[model samples]
Target: MNNTEFQAARNRPGVERQSFKKRLSDAKFLLILFAPAMVFYILFEYLPMFGLVIAFKDYNAFKGVWASEWVGFKYFSYFFQNPDFLVLLKNTLLLGFYSILFGFPAPILLALLMNELRSIFFKRFVQTVSYLPHFISNVIMVSMIIMFLSPTSGMINQIVQWFGGDPIYFLSKPEYFRTIYVTSGIWQGVGWGTIIYLAALSSIDPHLYEAAEIDGAGRWKKMWHITLPGIVPVMFILLILNVGSLMSTSFEKVYLLYNPLVYSTADIFSTYTYRVGLLQGNFSYSTAIGMFNGITSFLLLYAANFAAKKIKQVSLW
Candidate 1:
């Protein structure tokens, strides 16, 4: 085109293209703000995703990922046909169900209780103490539990003996494994979990509470009518997220707390995968099992999202 025509086009509204320099200038601050997070996500999350291909191959240490021979789904078939699969599935689901049934409500209850506290000093003290356990390392927490519940000489067993009861092997008993694991998780996690609900509660308007009080509503009535209703959306959103991860349990906690005696009840999918893949050095087979797990998780998430949308009109997507 001629210079005159190009000049006319630039002068027209919507005719001129956005200059790269101007666009960059406008987005500089936002780009800077997001750069670190973008880098971290790529490095820690997306980069590792490339390794998932190992699951489809008979990965050899010397041959490496690209050189490994493709084995199709032989490992996955083995996992499905294995006798231990049913036991692992049952244990994982039962533990997860128990956690949801008991552990899910504990945080909500704790948050509600904290919201009701009138004294600022007492409330601060309680929250501070509650959150401490959440920061404790898993190794330290498991060690403390073992020491506290040791049948030979632990404080719990000693107390039971004092009351004319026999010392119970809490860790070794399969029947007690789920109970101990769930309760310990509750104690360690409930307080920190309450922080999210508490933040959601803070976003609620104070006027709602004041209006409820003027209408002859007491603490219980206000909580039931106002506070509970206010947090229902937050509760529902979090519940959806939780349901999406129903298969996952903290592997460290289970592996650390369980012994051979309680493995019948405590062995879950993650621990099982760790044993077969990591300890046994069946890298290809383990990768297949891991891939199966990822696929199952994806399916579960989609199913849960669909159910949520149908039943409550809430969903992740």
Candidate 2:
């Protein structure tokens, strides 16, 4: 049969579809390329899910996960009743919310400013300088923050002394913890975050800008009309992802930067989990807390995605 006749025959109800084996053989090369990622997720991500059962168990190390006695919702109830529960939840939510409020827009603003730079050399230099902080290890970054904010010997204190003002121990002050954490986080991640928006901006049609220029639109007008809209989809996707992880504050950075003095303001779910699970060996309770955190994140993700889809017609899915 000719091409059209063969296509018509294939589209008929009685025609059999291609077998799975046939399709797999046809795309074998592509599947081979994808195999490593699939294996990695299965091994590292999905397999660990089996251990989540420990959250419901007494979780004796000697008895092992499967052999441990199930305690149902005992740990969850214990956590709910704990006096520190509200404090931990409040701190975690406030820190996450502040980080999102400040850190989210910082990179976008930086990218927009970078895009407007007339000198290519200066733009590249600024980008490189900004991105360098992202590569700094959490330990090193926190240490630097401590050194800078030290009341007696720190640069900040030195500057204060030069101005004949009192030196403030910034890290030890509970009121300053959120601001310092959020600002440092922005410094570390802003340049890396700009990468996505910059990519989106690059893909905008050059003709749109040309047309805007011809219509007597200035730089700000063109940016407001063309540049911002061009990146809205990318912005929405990142925002949803950010909102989904709203409860997941950086444990490493917080642990390194905070002390007993700042625990009231700085203690979060992850840090608390670490202290309970590893330090104190209350594995069951820690696992329960971790499970609660995971569930909260999942719900946040779902809600954010749903809202994005309904309001903006944009979503990760």
Tell me, by lDDT, which candidate is best: 2
TM agreement with the true structure for every prediction: 0.88, 0.93
Q: List the residue pairs that clash in candidate 2.
A: none
Cα misplacement distance, residue 245 of candidate 1 (Å):
2.1
After superposing candidate 1 on the true structure, give the runs of residues whose Cα lies further than 4 Å from its correct spot: 1-27
Query: What lDDT tens digits, residue by residue, belong to model 1 across residues 237-262?
Result: 77766765777878999999998998
Candidate 2 segments exceeding 4 Å error: 1-27
For all candidates in order, the CA lDDT equals 0.87, 0.93
Winner by TM-score: 2
C-alpha RMSD values across all candidates: 4.7, 2.5
- What are the per-residue Cα lDDT tens digits for candidate 2 across 1-317? 99999998878765545555678889999999999999999999999888889989999999898899999999999999999999999999999899999999999999999999999999999999988999999999999998898898899899999999999988888999999999999999999998878889999999999999999999999999999999999998999999999899999999998899999999999999999999999999999999999999999999999999998899988
> Which 10-residue window in model 1 sums to the lowest lDDT?
13-22
